[model samples]
Target: MGAVTMGCGDSCPLVRAKVREEWNIPDPKDLPDDDFRKIRDLIEQKVTSLLAQPTG
Candidate 1:
């Protein structure tokens, strides 16, 4: 999967509820650009790191 995924504003209460309940994730789309950019960067870093990690 790609490092970043984008979605329209949170319109689905069930999806939002499930996400909040399960992941504890704040909606990134609601965040300011700088914050969302930082999240995007962090996701990229995590994906890169995972790809680099040694695997059996």
Candidate 2:
């Protein structure tokens, strides 16, 4: 679940919808295998932590 924008706000659909995107700095999109692995690991960590939270 990610949103791709053309750099401007107020015009971007996500901005208008008030949807917040993840903070994935350094543009890991077309990175090498190692970089991809690192990004994957980071996302996995976030997911694990989120799932561990108690929901009421």
Candidate 3:
């Protein structure tokens, strides 16, 4: 099992993950459209990078 956390901190609870990753992205709620798009793009880039990694 794998886990990806997006800056939720203590409000989120994830247990016993075989692979865990925490991405320190800002909360985009109520942000301006431009800022939201930038955050979204960052998340997309991070995901793309992760996917490009070779898995065991």
Candidate 4:
């Protein structure tokens, strides 16, 4: 199985997995709407890139 982690803290349990992507984006909670939108866009971009990759 594959794993994708976003803003996972230092003690993330899935970090040791062989097939995982860690996007240590900061927590967007309580942020202004514009700032949260930017973070959301970034995450969407990463997801798009990941989806474009060829799977084994």
Best by lDDT: 3
Residue by residue across 1-56, what tens digits does model 3's lDDT show?
66788876653454766788889999988899999999999999999999998887
Model 2 residue runs over 4 Å out of place are: 1-22
Error of 4 at 54 (Å): 0.5
lDDT of each: 0.53, 0.59, 0.85, 0.80
Model 2 agreement with the true structure over 1-56: per-residue lDDT tens digits? 33434223334563443333444445568999899889788777866875686754
Candidate 4: tens digits of C-alpha lDDT, residues 1-56: 56787765454574465577779887888889999999999989999998999888
Model 4, backbone clash pairs (residues 3+ apart or across chains), number: 0
Expressed as tens digits, the lDDT of each residue in 1-56 for candidate 1 is: 11222344444444423222122235668899999988778667766776796754
The top-ranked prediction according to TM-score is: 3
Backbone clashes under 3 angstroms, per model: 0, 0, 0, 0
What value does the lDDT take at residue 5 in candidate 4? 79
> How big is the RMSD of model 2?
5.4
**What TM-score does each of the candidates earn?**
0.51, 0.53, 0.81, 0.77
Model 4 segments more than 4 A misplaced: 10-18
